[model samples]
Target: MKKIDVIVKYFYPLAAGIEINVRNVYKHMVSHGWDVTIHTSTDMPEAKNSLPVIDHLDGMNIHRYPWRWYGFVPRIDWAHTPAIALHNFNIFPHSWLLIIVLIRRTLGMSSPKVFLTPHGGFTPEWRTFSPLSRFIKKTYQEILGVHLINAAVDGLRSVSDWEAVESIKHGMRPDIIHIIHNGLEREVYTQIEKLANQVTTDQVRKLGRYLIQIGRIHPIKNQATGIKALKHLPQDIQFVIIGPVTDPEYKKSLDLLISQLGLFDRVHFLGVISGVNKYYWLRHSVVNVHMALWESYCNVIHESMSQGCVCIVSRGTALEELIKDKINGFCVPEYDEVSVADAVKYILDSSHARQILAMRKRNTDFTRGHSWQNISLQVEKMYTTALGS
Candidate 1:
C-alpha cells in the first residue's frame, strides 16, 4: 500500500492547534483507505514509555520519537519505505528533519517527497518572539532552508492567503503552494448538540451568561483583553476561558490581571476541555470571543461558528476572512479594553434577537459543509498531483 508520513513537533496528549488539525486530516485520510503514519516528537512524558513508540489514533498510525538535545533524527528503519513526508511547521525540530532528508537524498539513499506547511510560523512576530528563532530561521533560510524547500519539497500547504503570501516572501515557488482552509470534524456538532440536550438549568446557572474564549492560553491569544472587557460588560455577563496554559508566564499574567481587576468571581478558567463539554460551552454561550495577536486561520472561530454561536474575533488576522463585521459575527477593531468592550456591548444591545438568530444560522450553515472528509479529499488530490510530478 502507498503511504504518507507526517513530521510535526508534537502529537497526542498535547492539544496544540496544529496537532489537532493534523490528527483530523490523517483520520480522514485513513478513512479513505490511505495508510498514513505520523512522525512527531515525543513531548509528553506519558507518551515516552518506549523509544520510537507506535500508537493508533483516529484509525491512523502515530510514530513518536524522543527529542534529542540538538534536534530530532528520523528513524533509520523508516527511511527505506520511501514515503511522502509532510513537514508541519518550519522551525526547531522540522529544520533538523528537513536537513536529514536532504542529506540522505544527496547520498543517493531512499528519500520521501516532502510537502511543507509553515503553519504561520514565519510571521513577522516570529522574529520578536525569540532571538534564537530569528537567528536560526534567518540563518538557515539564507543558507539551507530555502534551498532544501526548493530541492526536496513537492509543494507547500497554506491554511490562509496570508500564509501563502508569507511562503512566497520566504522564497517558495508560487506554483507549488496549495491553500486549503482548516476544518473541524463534523461529529463535533453532533456531540455539542447532544450535550446541549443534557445541559440543565443548574449547569446553565453555573456556566453563567458568559462570553467564552477557547484556545491555548498563550501571550499571543491576548486573553487579558477578554478579562478586561468584563468591566465594561454587564455584571452578569461573565468571561469563561478554556484551553491549556501553553505558557506559564502568560497564565500568571492573566491571573494577576484577574486579581487586580477584582474579577476573580467573574472570570473563570476551565483548562483544557474537549469532546462534548467543549461544544456545550460554545452552544450555550452568549457569544464566543478570540482576540489573538494573529492567526494563520483559527479553528476555534469556526468551531464556535459551527456550534451556532456568534463570535467577536480580532481584526487583521485570517479570522477577518471568516467574519464580515456584524454580518455573521463581530470583529474587535483593536485588542484594547475599549474595543473589546464595545464589540461585546454591540452584540448584546444592538443585534436584535431575530437578527442574532439569523447570524447564527448563517454561521452554522457556512461551516456545516467544511468537514474533515471534504478537506482530506482536497488533500488527496494534492497528493496525487505530487506523485504525478
Candidate 2:
C-alpha cells in the first residue's frame, strides 16, 4: 500500500486541534486503504515521561524525533514575564527531516508523498509576537521556509482560506495551498447522544442561561471581550470560559478586568473540560461566543455547532467562514462588545426564539458536511494529485 508522509511538531495525543485533524483525516484514510506515517517532535510538555519513539495505532506508523522546546534559545517561563515583552528565535528541526525524506523519495528510496499541514503555524502576522519574535518569524519564513521547505513539500494543507491567504503573503505558493477545513468524527455526535439523557454538568446547572467559550486562556482567544459584553447583558445570563490557562499573565489581566467591571460573579472559568461534560455545557449554553483575535480555524465553534449549540464568531478569520453572520450564526468584530451584546440580546429576546431555532438547525446541517469521512476523501484526492496521476 502507498503511504502519505505528515511532518508536524506534535501528534501523539488527541488533545490539540492539529493532532485531532491528523487523527481524523488519516484515520479515515486508513479505512479507505491508504497508509500514513507521521513524523513528529518529542517535546511533550504535559507528559511525565517521554512517549515511545515509535508506535502503531489505528493502522498508522508513527516516528517521533527529539526536539528542543525553544531550539537553541532558552525556554522562557512565560508565567513570570509578560508575553509581549519577550521574544526568542529558533530553527524547526522538522524541516531537516522533511527535506531528507523528500530527497529519499525523489531518489526512489521511499514511496510516500510528503504532505505539510501548517496547522496554524504559518501566519503572516503574529497576534502575540514580541518585536524580536516578529523579526525571527520573517527570517525563518524567508530563509528556511520559502527557499527549501516549501520547495520540498508535496502538498500544503491550510485549515482555512484565511490561512492559505496569509501563507501566500509570507512565502508559500498559491498553487500548492489546499484549503481543507477541520472536520467532525462520528464519535463526536454519538457522544452527544449518549450524554443527552443525563443531567447537565454541575457547572452548567450552576450558571443557567449562560454563554460559553472553550479555548486556552490567551489574548489570542479573546475571552476578555466575552466578559466585557456581559456588562450589557442581563444578570441571569452569565459567561463560562473553559480551557487551560496557557497564558498566566493574560489570565491575571482578565481577572483584574473582571473585578473592574464588577463581573467577577458572572464570569466563571472551568479549566480543561472534556468528553461528555464539555459537550454538556456546549449543548445547554444560550450560545457559544468565540471571538478569538486570530485563528486559521476555530475548532471549538465547529464542535459546538455539531452539538446544536448556536455560535457568534468574529469576522476576517476562519471563524467568519464557518458562521455566516446571522444566517447560521452571528459574526461580530473580534473586540466589539456592543455587537456581541446585541447578538446575545437578540438570541435571548422572546421574539427571536423561532429565529434561534432556525439558526441551530442551519448550523447543525452545515456542520454535517464537515464529517471526517469527507475530509479523508479530500485528503486522499490531494495525495493522489501529488503523485501526478
TM-score of model 1 (CA atoms): 0.90
Candidate 2, after superposition: displacement of residue 104 in Å? Answer: 5.6
| CA RMSD per model (angstroms) | 2.8, 7.4
Residue-wise lDDT of candidate 2 within 1-389, one digit each (tens)? 35555555566563566667777788787888765666565555445237687778788877776766433122222223111100011246545544555676567663344566766676733757898988887777777866654666667778888878877887677888788888876656665645643444555666779999998787888999999999999988889899876678899999999999998789989777776677778888999999888877877898898878889898877778778887889988989999999999999888988989998998788787777888888877887777765
Q: Which segments of candidate 2 are over 4 A away from where they belong?
A: 12-14, 32-37, 44-66, 69-91, 98-112, 169-171, 191-202
Q: Write the per-residue lDDT of candidate 1 for residues 1-389, one digit (tens) a residue.
A: 45787777677767768878888777887887878778777665233434447777887777777777654655544465545555455556666666767898889887777777777765545523688767877787777777777777777788888888877887888888899888876667575554544544346568668899999888888888889889988888888888877788888998899889999889888877787677777888888878888888888898888888898888887888887788998887546778778877766775487878888999989887798778878877787677662
Deviation in Å, model 2, residue 145 alpha carbon: 1.8
* Candidate 2: worst-modelled 10 consecutive residues by lDDT: 81-90
TM per candidate comes to 0.90, 0.82
User: For candidate 2, what is the TM-score?
Assistant: 0.82
Query: Candidate 1's error at 218, in angstroms?
Result: 0.7
